[model samples]
Target: MKNAISIAMMALFSLCCAAQNISVQSINYPTRYLRHSDSKGYLGEMLSDLDRQDASFKLVNAGIPDCPNCIRFESVNYPGQYLRHSNYLIWLSALSSDLDYKDASFRLVQGLAGTDRVQRTTHADVFR
Candidate 1:
């Protein structure tokens, strides 16, 4: 039981590390405690974890946009499948690039106005 728990946690850490251009850091996005976010900066499966050990997290968005194909995710019992999808990771990388561009643009705008910019920082979605 102890080894299994350790392995599961390790898999979770790897998922966090899968973010593009990610820096080495303590991975702590436990699916059990994740709260939903749709702040444009948030990503990953709409649902966090379904296991009884933790609460299941769903997106916090009040309303769904008219997007045709909403992204969905199902947690896997296996570690390998939990973090190895090309298209999913590719989408995450694109989201990261988009966030970088958006942040820079906002900073430039604030700098010219001589105003202290409010930071809208977000993590690079680990799905990438």
Candidate 2:
């Protein structure tokens, strides 16, 4: 019974990690957090902010079993949209069939020890 309960708890923890809210921070500018502009548009709208609410994003799985690390980020305040990089900038975009080109996929990685930085890498293998 104890082992079964432990397994269930572990599964729950994994599920939480699969759809966790994370803040993307700039490694270069440690004080800044990745953020989308107030305007709801694509391209040239990526920026950084010091506010946590503006920086928070829900990181969810892209549902590709082959690529376990492939994931998408959704805004906590906005629904039905995912984070994508356009023109080397970040923006929230609706779901698209062209997953390869939509640039909506990313991989979350831990930064150095004792730091609050999280790195997001797109499917193109570009870091943001």
Candidate 3:
């Protein structure tokens, strides 16, 4: 009975952890979600299973060791790849250098419009 209870608890914990996966949606276009295609990030409507998978991401700790408060968005389908911006455009890329880590890390703040929405703001200090 104790072993069964332990197993059930472990299963519940796994489900709770899996629930951390999130889909980033556009504020203006609620029907559209952030997705990567051809390594580029764009907003698209989730019409198929592939679309949904592309839209899904896991919020992980920042890849940079110095940025403890920052978070990085890791692609659900592409485990090692993370959401990053380069040349003022978002892309799904693998971390290779400090610049890549900095580009991927973002601080989550309350949206300017309201608290109901969350905004991912780049770490200005690192960028500048």
Q: Number of the top candidate by TM-score? A: 3
Q: Candidate 2, which segments miss by more than 4 Å at Cα?
A: 1-20, 39-50, 99-102, 109-118, 124-128
The residue-by-residue lDDT of candidate 2 on 1-128, one tens digit each, is 34443453344336536755766556566666666556242222234342455566776667655556667767776766777777766667677667533478775444443234334466564322
lDDT of 1: 0.24
Candidate 3 lDDT over residue span 18-68, tens digit each: 647878889989999999999999999999999999998987766455555
Give every collision pair in model 1. Answer: none
TM-score of every candidate: 0.18, 0.60, 0.79
Greater-TM-score candidate between 1 and 2: 2
Residue 11 in candidate 2 has what lDDT?
A: 42
Highest lDDT: give the candidate number: 3
**What order do you get sorting by lDDT, best first?**
3, 2, 1
Q: For model 3, what is the C-alpha lDDT against the true structure?
A: 0.78
Task: Pick out the ten consecutive residues of candidate 3 with the lowest summed lDDT.
Answer: 8-17
Pitting candidate 2 against candidate 3, the one with the higher TM-score is 3
**Where does candidate 3 stray beyond 4 Å?**
1-19, 63-68, 126-128
